[model samples]
Target chain A: MSEVILELDAVVKKFDDNEVLKGISLQLHRHEVVCLIGASGSGKSTLLRCVNLLETIDQGTITLFGQSLNDPRIDPDQVRRHTGMVFQSFNLFPHLSVLENVLVGPVRALKRKRSDVVDEAMHLLERIGLSDRAKEFPERLSGGQQQRVAIARSLAMKPALLLLDEVTSALDPSLVGEVLDLLRDLATSGTTMLIATHEMNFARDVAHQVAYLDGGVLVEQGAPDQLFTNPQHDSTRLFLERVR
Target chain B: MSNITDESVSEERPSFFVPRRKQLLVGRRGIVASTLSVVIFLGGLVAVFYLAPGGAAVRRFYFDRHDMWEAFVGNHNAGLSSVGIGIFTNIWVFLVSEVFILIFGLTIAWTRMSKSPVLLPFRILATIYSDIFRGIPVLLVFFLVGFGLPPLGIAVVSYQSVAVYGCVALTLTYSAYVAEVFRAGIYSVPHGQLLAARSLGLTNATTMRRVILPQAVRTVIPPLLNDFISLQKDTALLSLLGVIEAVNAGTIYQDTKFNSSGLVVASLLFLAMTVPLTRFTDGLIARDRKRRLASS
Candidate 1:
């Protein structure tokens, strides 16, 4: 088996009186694409947000690439740089252009020369088929195009693990195809991704491991064919039926 | 039983009233109020015109005006030698004063970021400086430096030296105000931006220098321009200290001519320098607001 790139051990997150993550634990191999699926408020997206430290966990531990994400010794900022997140809102800097947004991390975070980062950012933009829109502001682009830019931004960081927090959940139906296609391309390239999404068919097609979740608990997990065709949990069966 | 397209089932006792988009145009009363106000204002304008001294006053006002314009004209008031002297001697001092204010204000504002007990007094001092200077008018500051501070080891100088004192007084009075402006602007930047920059492994200084201050300053360009225009007008108050800036020279002409036209000339001269800046700041504010709206 490939080495584990990430592991969450009995991670628990609570907000006020409500518990969002109830002692969740999981492990993923390097270059694995794990799809997390469930109904609304299932803690799937919150789990992904937790991986990048956007949402803090109240207790337990998370390790990414042998680095303890929950360790006091770990710098959360440094951990954030190695593990990239693509937000549902696509939080591109409004003042920056598309190309500048991609270069923001490399130039500002990595402290690379502007001349150097430009070519790399340009190449990354071309990879996402947005070279022409590089000079354009995000407001000028369609929702799919902005999401593509957000992906390019994540890819620019060259992260070891990618955490996607319902990236296409905000898209219109017509724009979902392009974003999914790009994600499929990323998955095929063996980039490790933990995608928390509501799009069942896309998850089935692109995911290597599909897990069903219910109310902050991982209910069932298996290969896509096994889980969808033969769910062992009654909750999973009922949930799938509702979504269908 | 259907994907929300079952019109036949929907026909069974359901109200499907699509909301018409509401029009938010002002009513007839608002329009009447606006028209009535405009007429009243125009009537006031006509009343002023009737009350104002007629052709003689305007003829007096319009002539010998635009001295800053006439200063560059045929060598009449001062020599070409002195005009170059005026531009270089006085204008460079003005530029220096502006630069000095910008630097000192930035320093004063950033000093509040220090976490020292010694800086506690400085913070209180800076706050008091801003409040006292900003609370009191600019002219009073000039008067203090010109009249009040003179006997206390600070002899007031004349000509260019007087301008320097005026600039210094401007700096003292307005630095505190500008510092407060900078402080308010820096605080206006969202804390998330600083956190994001910090997350990039940037040091506190580098994050502030690279990300926070630049963005914050862009948002505050309008207010900064307002301060600049006010400073330029306050340059006139320097006449109390005997500095022969544009307005001061106009005052000199008024004294010689025994006419109020020089005051009008001075006001127009002040307007000439300030109107473009006012428009430019307005444009900057509008553009920033539009960009923010679009982004949100």
Candidate 2:
């Protein structure tokens, strides 16, 4: 079977008068770790947001797990189930304990039994290495700790594909390393991921492939060795030079 | 030895304050001033009464009074009289009106906060009702409900009915004021609280039920208790339409028979209801203030 699990065909999205995505096309295979590296306002995050229908595309087709996402006939709710996105702000429910926050989307939306959800939540928290902090409120946790809890919250649903929008952007410089390590672990474990990130080293060392974006279009994409080492496109070379 | 110890500083740890003497420090000024004022005022009264031109005539006029006490006790109207006939006429009206006010006020308040377009009309109606009722005097509201409405096919009610309607009118007006208090309490919650609720994938209904209203209602209770207290006193306004609340009862008693002491009795009745309410509200207010201070 072909490894491709997600594909976007000729996607275009505009925000008011400004076009944020300009006819972008890409395919993400199973167990693949892809990083979208670009400067601020370069449409990297918008592209990721479009994948799960967080930001509606003006025109395009998104296919995930052999199913078209957000189709005119398909229920948008179904697409939400297969993909979960973690935001930079680590938007964990503050009034709820970490475990309850993780269990909410599953037990409530997925209609899983409470007992079963609890077991799954513990396992997910353990994977994020914050199993002991499960009963604490989000306010009680550090930024890095909360982000991990957010990851565990999404993981509790056991999504087939995850969207990460600069997950470490809100963390302290010291705390960013620990969350990046967790993301690296998730990638190595063969979880399919599409990350729009600023951590150059993480995008360099861990990404199976890196796509550099500029002016709302994918400028260059290839195996990390080729894209990171030898630049084909002038825009890609200048982007890397600015970052490095 | 006991008698000797009592006289000595060395006795029983030299009791810093001899048991009953503790009162001398805390209440000395109040007791002395109140006692002296009463004595001095009474002394002046006796001098005035004894020295005044019609002193003996005054004594004769006062001492040989009719059997008014017997009339007050034996007459069925007297029970109503002691209640202040005017107040008795309207107390029931006040109570029934207040009940309707609570229901409708809470409804309007909750509606005002709703997102529905239908609720907007209610919100606007509430604003208009509160504005109109609050702007006009209570007497005007009484006239409208009791006298004015009757001419438009509503039956011309008895003073008792008018009084009751008056109470209803007042509560209707004040309940909106009270509802605003509740709305403020609900809105004071931080935004993070709601965002957390939404991201849980909870429907808006469930979010309000589980997380929002409960917390908001906690801050609302103390202020509500205060409004209830004020409502009790405001009920006196019903006397204008002729229900015999305590004040009107005293007025009626004073008018029917010749005695001014009924005024004192009426004051006592109001103080009876208001004092406890004020004390209780003050205690809660104090506790809440302290909590707020400590939190800050």
lDDT of 2 by residue, B1-296 (tens): 34564454563455566467546435666688678789999999999999999987755433323323322222464543545343334345545765776677667667777776767877788778767766887667766776765556634453335555666577767777777777787787666455544444455556666567656665776777677666766777766666666666655655766654455555555666667767887787677555533412
TM-score of chain A of each: 0.97, 0.96
Taken over the whole model, the C-alpha lDDT of each candidate is: 0.75, 0.73
Q: lDDT per residue, candidate 1, B222-288, as tens digits?
A: 7888888877767667667766555555555555545445455456656766798788878877887
> Any runs in candidate 1 off by more than 4 Å, and if so which?
A12-23, A38-46, A70-73, A114-119, A210-241, B1-94, B100-136, B139-218, B252-257, B278-296
* Shift in Å, residue B288, candidate 2: 13
DockQ of each model vs. true complex = 0.15, 0.11
* Top lDDT hit: 1
True contacts kept of 2: 0.12
Question: Model 1, range A1-244, lDDT digits (tens) per residue?
Answer: 6999889988999988799999888888888899999988999978887887767899888888887777768776677677777877776655668898788777777778999888988998898899988887777889999989988887888888888879899999899999999999999999999999988898889888998889999888999989988999999999989888
Error of 2 at B286 (Å): 13
Give the proportion of true interface contacts each model preserves, from 0 to 1. Answer: 0.21, 0.12
